[model samples]
Target: MEHREPGYVADKAQLLKRLRRAEGQVRGLQRMVEDDVYCIDVLTQVSAATKALETVALQLLDDHLAHCVAEASAEGGPVAEEKLREASAAIARLVRS
Candidate 1:
């Protein structure tokens, strides 16, 4: 990977916070399942966790495209092209998911 200035440094803390919340949600879902909570309720928690994960993944993808790709392009050469390719592949995976 090309070394460049951070794109989403400012949002790092917030991202961590969101991840922690997702972790808690996962734990909550586990507890709900263990407690034999209603089936719909457990499914609801699963949906929430999935959505939260998707949200975070989107944010990271956006940052990678905007900051990392931009920086790599500015630097120019094979490295930038590689980064672009990697980002494209990642996006494809995300879309499939």
Candidate 2:
């Protein structure tokens, strides 16, 4: 896989921790399915995983705007504006999803 930027990598570490927890939740869900556990319990686990992912996405987006976009803008010219546009589009797409 490609390397993450330093700031992003820091956020990614936290996200990865959350993902691992979510992974455990998925395994629990799988066991629930296998053991004929309640349907609502499994659904609740799924919802938790989705929310965890969304939280990670929002954290990364906030960091990108605060650091990368800010740095690019400070340097002047089109790069900063382009980065902001890209980040905005990405955020929009994420929200729509």
Candidate 3:
């Protein structure tokens, strides 16, 4: 079954654009390594890319909580608890990262 909710649909375009830019940054990092650019500079770019990805993750988490989890909570049952647990685990993983 296809789970097609509007999770993050509103930020879809902006998210894609950010992800593409992050992709380009990763490519640039590869090139920098191949060209033997300064280690610090490359690390700086890596940090930028990492932050970009983190931002995407955060936005996704927010959307999930606002849409899926909220809906599930309103329903009030095992599914709601499952959704809350899922969100908590996701947030934990993000925090660890």
Q: Which candidate is the best by TM-score?
A: 3
TM-scores for candidates 1 onward, in order: 0.89, 0.78, 0.94
Task: Give the number of colliding residue pairs in candidate 1.
Answer: 0
Model 3 accuracy (lDDT, Cα): 0.94
lDDT of 1: 0.89
Residue-level lDDT tens digits of model 2 in 1-97: 2344744766777878988987887788889899998888889888987888788788888888887888778987888778889898989999898
C-alpha RMSD of candidate 3: 1.4
**Candidate 1: where is the Cα deviation over 4 Å?**
1-6
Lowest-sum lDDT 10-residue window in model 3: 1-10
Top lDDT prediction, candidate number: 3
Error of 3 at 47 (Å): 0.4
What local lDDT score does residue 33 receive in model 1, on the 0 to 100 scale? 90
Worst 10 residues of 2 by lDDT: 1-10
Better candidate number, 1 or 2, judged by TM-score? 1
Off by over 4 Å in 2: 1-4
RMSD of each: 1.6, 3.2, 1.4
Clashing residue pairs in candidate 3 (N, C-alpha, C atoms within 3 angstroms): none
